[model samples]
Target: MEETSITAEPGKQEIVISRVFDAPPDLVFKACTDPELISRWWAPESITTTVEKMDTRPGGMWRVTQRDAEGNEYAFHGVYHEVTPERIVDTFEYEAMPGHVLLETETIEDLGGGRTKMTDHLIFQSVEDRDGMLQSGMEEEMTGPMERLAELLQSLKQAAPAR
Candidate 1:
């Protein structure tokens, strides 16, 4: 079993989540980059996600549609600024609210011993926007999705021995 930690700095408009998974860095990175795997745990629990497009390369564009329990939908689109096997940088925006944009970079560090540390750094255009998201329950929404990701990795680890 691996440990997970999440941290946030309200003043800095930063949220950092760290989790140790019992999988190699490459595999862990793929779990994030692959649309199929992403959709499996992208939204909070009981919500659903659909990837309309996902071209994970420099200058490529990606879009995902998420629906909540009440059937309310939101779409997110992004352009990849940088894409490597273990790191990705992109500009993200919600289609419903186009003006609210965020620059996000995610890095995966190989910790050796079948462990990886994934960090997501999201930079908003203004502190107000960041604070608004926090007040909108972004942290709570993130909890279930992250937990599902950990469970997914655990299942992968268990299945590996049978393969």
Candidate 2:
């Protein structure tokens, strides 16, 4: 299992999430940015996720929808502001809460020996918005999907021929 860490300060308008994957940086980044691979592990047990649209270049757009067990659909859309082998910067907003947007930057660090670390920083519109997310079971919601991501990466690596 991957170790995941999340920190959110009471007054700071930022959320930091980090996790180490047992895969190389390039493969980890591919799993994150590839729509097909992403759709497989981006949702928790009770929710089904689908990539509605994905464009992985700077200024490109993406939209994904998650449907809960109760059939409630939640959509999120974002525009990529920057994209590099090691990092990505994007805007993120839930469709229901239009203006409560945030800037998210994801960095993948090569940790040597086939290990990769991903750090995600989310700068929210305000402290209140950040706090609200923290209080809304965000950590619990993320943990499962992140674990799923690790599993998916492990499987992917296993399937690849040894290099």
Off by over 4 Å in 1: 1-4, 161-163
Model 1 shows how many backbone clashes? 0
Clashes of each: 0, 0
Identify the candidate with maximal TM-score. Answer: 2
Best by lDDT: 2
lDDT for each residue of candidate 1 in 15-85, tens digit (9 for 90 to 100): 66667666777777777889998999888877799989999989999999998899999999999999997
| Root-mean-square deviation (CA) per prediction | 1.9, 0.8
TM-score of 1: 0.90
How much lDDT does each candidate structure score? 0.82, 0.92
User: Model 2 clash tally?
Assistant: 0
